[model samples]
Target chain A: MGIAREHDLHKRRFSRNRGVGLALAAFVAIIFGLTVVKVSNMDVVGSYAAGSLTAGGDK
Target chain B: MSDTSARTTPPPAIGGEGDFADYFALLKPRVMSLVVFTALVGLLVAPVPAHPMIALAAILFIAIGGGAAGALNMWWDADIDAMMQRTKARPIPAGRVAPGEALAIGVALSGMSVVMLGLAANWVAAGLLAFTIFFYAVVYTMWLKRRTPQNIVIGGAAGAFPPMIGWAVATGGVSPESLLMFLIVFVWTPPHFWALALFVRSDYEHAGVPMLTVTHGRRATRAHILAYTLLLAPVTIGAGLTSVGGPVYLMVAVALNLWLIWGALNIRRRSEETATADGYRAEKAFFRFSIFYLFLHFGALLAEAALRPYGLGGW
Candidate 1:
């Protein structure tokens, strides 16, 4: 019985840790995804950035 | 699960190889949050509107650059950080991250942030980002921090640059409004930091950092706080006359600035003995309130920007 109880406690701890890790990952991913999606809607034709690129297009 | 527990119980970390969280802490997420928020306000409040995507990219680059600067600071300040109680738990000081590793990450991220931002936005914004990082890492951290009591006053420029960069992102240049935003933070920084120094002077003294309180004594520090407050009030109110400000910002600026000035005066009157007896209550309160003051002032600008679409903002 003691062994079984300890196992259950260990499982609970693992689950709790996994929950925290997953929550962190989800928060980061959501923010990243939203930013990319919002910017994707705008049409980007070419580089209007400062300097010129090289032979083909950009440097 | 029991087997997993046994496996996880390894010996204590030596040489601080560092975990993911340690790396994240090195980025100084708290400071980055402030940079991101203020930059967002600057972007939104500018006269020119950016495509949502462009805005997002610019902010990400700005945030990454800010975080890079923070990592560099941690690497450089690790010695002093280890010496002080307040900073002893930081990743480097606490032995969770190695100095070389922090330096490498800082340099790499700085280059990436600057270059990528140049591609994502105009060169103007990217240039500001580059300068901000260089100013923070080299000028503020390496040169000024240990040398002068005026560190916070002059180094405040690094923190004050983000809004201008954000403004540049949208407008591709600066305006009177953006300069006003920069000036407000510039003037506000010394008072804000000095108030905290009044309470934490011992920490800086122990760490060998020449904070105003440590160098000038509390009397001079407190007097400076009041003087800065007097200068700050006019600038804060003057912001209301700029394009970025409206009724919301004006009202917030006046109310908050008055409270801060009063807090400074209160602090100026108290002796250190009385302050210690009171546990630095008034100073601590002023410090806390100053944080709220900046947040509310910037928040008011954001609110004004949001209201502009509804004809509720601007002169």
Candidate 2:
């Protein structure tokens, strides 16, 4: 019984961790995309601040 | 159960029935959330700008680093945590996660966060994050916590570094504005934590951690709270005078400091007998308010940042 329980626990833990590395991979891809955006001179901060302020219109 | 069957089978998992949530708890999500928010504010309010995705990546790495510190802290303090009622049910102490697993996760994530932050941002930010993890895991948890009442006082620097790291990620260096944010949190920590110690005195006593209330009496601890809060008011106000601040931050700081100082004074005036009679209500209220004190201060910085394009922010 103890052995069976141990097997089940390990099974569950493994199942839970399944694709965790993939999730991390996605995060890495997103970070890579960010690096590309930064290197390419995508001025998201300045543009967004300008757009938002324009939209707000003196508020 | 034959000996052959037992020998053929594997042993029970050292921490039985542990689940995904238990591992998440090991990350100390609450602490991570606070670290993420402060780092984001630091990045946003910097004079230098970053791409949104880059900023997001930096915050993510910083949060992971904070969680790594928390996991390592839990691993080291498992024994003490088990003794304290407040932490007796943490993943390690509750037997939901093995200490070895926590340590593995901590060390692995520490390297991952620091290296990733370097890739996502700058080496300076990455170095700060690495030092933050080391300070929390080693200096605070392994060394100071069990030895002295000043553990949180010095260890608070670990928490205060996130904003500076964020600023470094944006500007590639620390500045007066970033230092001001760091100073506000650093000074705020003792008063904030000491208030908690006042109410949760027995937990630290039972855990044998030498909190101020443990080393000195409640009266001295209360005195310390008042003294620190008084000292904190200036740093809190000084932050408003920096590039991060404007009318919004200044107004918020002044109002909050008045209330915080009042709370500390109230606690100072109340005797231990009085606090006991009322269930330490004043200290509890102060503790609750202190959380808002930090959030609003940072929120005001965000507000100031937002208002900057309109020429309504900064000195």
Candidate 3:
């Protein structure tokens, strides 16, 4: 019977587990987005490299 | 057999059944909102700009860091929270979340937020965020909160750091303007909190939190609010002279400070007996206005930044 899938404990904890799962997923997405931005040199390092020549440019 | 056992026996513990909302409550979302709004204004008003993704992530990390510090504070102040009517319904006090669990979450989130902020922004912002967490959790929560009447005065620095950190996120370091923003919030804190202390004096009394009202009497607390409000006026208006401040900010600052000082005067003039008769109407109104005062001040800063490109924002 696979230990009864409709356990009360699972029912009670479903929301918590879902919340944590969503949070972790969001964390991963943020990291991925940050990684993409950093690698594309769209962040601080990129601006520093571009210097005054690129200042007041696409911001 | 399992069904039979489940039907026959009750759950062993009801207190640990907290769901996601309870966990979120530990983060103090209301406080986080203030942190977010102030930090956003600080970031926007800076001369430099941040990438959209970086800016959004930096704010997110700062908010998370602020929330983590709140959780840590809740964990440490669980006992006091349990006694105070205003805080007794919090997650830890209500027994929805375990104290240890709250502490763990706080520590973990604090670490994650700092590291992530460093990656998304700059180390200067990250370092400032770390110091802010330490200031709130260790300095304010552990050392000062229960110790002195001036707790909120000094502890206010923790709340004041977010704007500075946001400015650093864009500029990669602190500047005069950022420090001006910090000073504005720093001075604004005592009056704002003291107003709440006036109405909810009993909460601090019962919690043994050593609030000004509990130690120095309501009359003294009222005077303190007015004193701080008087001191805050110049700092608030002085920001108008800075690069970040503009005509719009100055107008907003002048109007708000006038109203704030007027409100504080009303609070100071009232006797406890009169306040009780009026249900602390002036104090409560002052408290509510203080919130709007801060929001509009920051909003004016944002308006200046937004209008700067149009040649109408700054002095």
Candidate 4:
């Protein structure tokens, strides 16, 4: 009985740890996905022109 | 389960082998990317044409300065970072780098970047770069972060300085256009950050950081997000009317503002239980969208600059 109880506690602890790890991984994956989407959609060339004009107008 | 027993922990060291990649990571690449892009815009839009070589050097140094600030932030925040799930794996917290080593790297890079910028560009740009590093590392990281719920509100200023530094690089002075860009970023930081703060309140609480959610409660944070979003719309649109902005930027600004306002309004109306019922998914989506909104607005500014030669644009 003692051995079985110890084994069950270990199983529960292991499962709890796995759950936390999985949640953390999912969070990181979401942040990475968001970053990739933002970078891909960035209008880099257009921004350059707008920036230049702003500088030009100040003169 | 078997893998856990088989795993062997690596020895503790601040940065092993002194590899270029490790050094680069210390700079906070995401933040540096924004600094580079804004500075590039500042250079391109400036009436004064910098020789390509000088412009490249200026941008490179500005990026290095940005990295130095990140390294110092990591060093100081290492203790809290270890507690937060999101930051627990960072270099210092993970035991891959030492706090003191990170501090040294930050200080050395900070000086190098500033001095090189002064030589390759102008003293004004160098001065701005120096101030940015100081503001982020000293003022924001050291003084404000742990002490105030308004940390991000004030600390946000450090992040807002890049475009101004870039502008100074080209023109050796500040201008209304750069200030407008600065204002847009400044106002946007609160709502952008507070959205994440709401969802991650537990982490801040665990780390003992006084984020708005921790001090003011979730309802107050939601209210603040709405108020800031409302304030952000005009600043964003006004940038489109500046010499740097044009019809293309204006159209984008209007649409993005409306979408952001919708998200903020939705967030304000939802209860914590309701938000949890949706897996906090709506808040997550808003957080994701906020990142894109800033990138798009700045990207639109670049677009306006491109169309200027045809006499097709004015802000």
Candidate 5:
């Protein structure tokens, strides 16, 4: 009975740690994804601004 | 039984004394890349032209300011980072660099970037750089992040300021065009960030951070992502209609926004089990596409600038 109880406790602890590991992986992925999106969008914003400004100047 | 034991055991520690790469990591290279690219766009799109040397100086200063913000953010978030697995390997948390050292580097770079920009460009650009550093370090990292679910919503403003700073470097003041650029980024940030938040709620929960997922639940977070993307679509299209963007940008915005909206809508429609079964694969795919979306958009602006002399580009 004592050995069985010890094994159960170890299993619970293992599961808890696994949860943490998965959570960490998700967080890293999110940050990376966010960074890439922002960096990539820079040109769209810039060109749009330039086109409008030039058009306004001509008018 | 063998698999169970392997799963139950902790991975071996990869921690050790750091090297140059660790210091570079402390600067947050990915964030710096965004800052550099946006600032370059701001410089290029501005109505006033700058000498090449001055333009180079402005970009370098903006980059240094971005690095300063990263160092300080790492210093302040060291505790939470140590707790969170994703950040556990970071320079300060991983024991590669001391917190005090990071603090000093942050402070030194902040002053250097601001002063150099003021000299090479103008005081306005310098002032904006100083504000960007303070906003990221104090407002975003220290206060907003832990305090609210809207953390990224507001903290994202700091990231959006770089292009405006670049515009100021060229034009010596803020203009309507620069403000529009800032607005587009500001609106885009929430949807961009919340997509990731949907899948990473557990990490924020473990760190005791009140991200949208932790505060509002995954369903509400998904709804918010859709709402923000809807808002982002018009702003992106409007920006393409502006002076900085031309026909090329308009076409790109239309296509990317359509795809982005599709991704957001799919996330909204999917069941939690279905989303989770693939680890929110649709949302993850959207997040991946989001990165390319922004890169292509910005790269198009550079292309527009190159074509301007040939009468092939104009607002």
Candidate 6:
């Protein structure tokens, strides 16, 4: 018996798969961008911690 | 239960063919746009400056959280959505996406967005995003929506939280300006929705949603719209004195509030007979103008922020 190359289900699902794939790719990109941005701004975290500590001291 | 019978039976197609757009539709993209715009304004007008990438990621996560809440709302309200003309074409109601799928997507995105926001920004911002999602999905959708005519009045807080969260992303806490932004949207919601409810009068009634127009009558809803608009004028104009406010915002606020009050007064004075005869022309015009009113107010805030560097933006 000959094997079929593709099923109707596969054809119908193409757009959905593409969309999911694109979304995943975008997610990875956003994560990578955020990591770079956060790493570059080490002082931001430090200042935030310092600010919180000062506020607590005042309280 | 035989193999032969199973093979012959067609696969159930209830949610079998949902395209990517169908899934996106579950996210309520229109509402997402409002969240994004307001949140971005909040971020931009903050006293503290954020790096571009950080701001972008913060907005993306906030938008995702908002959309996730919308998906959960669709899942919960699928039944009533099917009964209403405005919502009957939504993903679940139209049978393009399964309710279970929407719920799963909502829950998954909610968790992911919150955690990612925490990592990208401060935990305070992330916490606000999480609370916003919970408020919209659980407090508003599950609790208040069907129970009272004041549903949107109280539930509007969920939509109002975005700019505050955006501000938190920058300043790591709330401030007078952020709260002012929140108040503007919160107060604006009732009149905006009431105007639409006035036009789409029967959708809520048919779906058993106790919208003010349905429960209190059109005349009362009109009055409520006028009252809310009058109340909104002070809150909006008063924001001009806050850190986010500037001469530009004040001018815009004064002009827009006048136009809004005029529109609301028109809506208040018209009887249901005149409205029905004119096909709710005044109500629809007011609804359209309300969108501009909110947009321009926020836009003016952005203008003030933008002009600050050049000494032309704000007071």
lDDT of 1 by residue, B155-201 (tens): 99999998999999999998888888888889989998999888888
Using Cα atoms, each model's DockQ against the true complex is 0.09, 0.31, 0.51, 0.02, 0.02, 0.52
Model 2's chain B yields a TM-score of 0.95
Candidate 4 lDDT over residue span B114-154, tens digit each: 99788777899999999999999999999999999999999
TM-score of 4: 0.79
Model 2: per-residue lDDT, tens digit, B123-177? 9999999999999999999999999999989999999999999999999998988
Q: What tens-digit string does per-residue lDDT give for candidate 3 at B150-204? A: 9999999999999999999999999989999999999999999999998998888
Candidate 6: list runs displaced more than 4 Å.
A1-12, A43-59, B1-13
Query: For residues B1-315, what per-residue lDDT tens digits would candidate 5 score against the true structure?
Result: 469888989764343335556666778999999999989998987878886667876797899899999999999999899888778889888776778878987998899889978977799999999999999999999999999999999999999999899999999999877887888778878888888777776777999999888888888988998998899888878877777788888888899999999999998898889998987899889888887877777777666777787988757
In model 1, how many backbone clashes occur? 5
| Regions of model 4 farther than 4 Å from truth | A1-59, B1-20
Winner by DockQ between candidate 5 and candidate 3: 3
Q: Any runs in candidate 5 off by more than 4 Å, and if so which?
A: A1-59, B1-17
In TM-score terms, candidate 5 sits at 0.79
Q: Name the lDDT of candidate 3.
A: 0.93
lDDT per residue, candidate 6, B62-123, as tens digits? 99999999999999999999999998988887877888999999999999999999988899
RMSD of 4: 13.5
lDDT of 1 at B38: 84
Error of 1 at B87 (Å): 0.5
> Model 1 residue B34 lDDT?
85
Pitting candidate 3 against candidate 4, the one with the higher DockQ is: 3
Question: All candidates' lDDT scores?
Answer: 0.86, 0.91, 0.93, 0.84, 0.83, 0.93
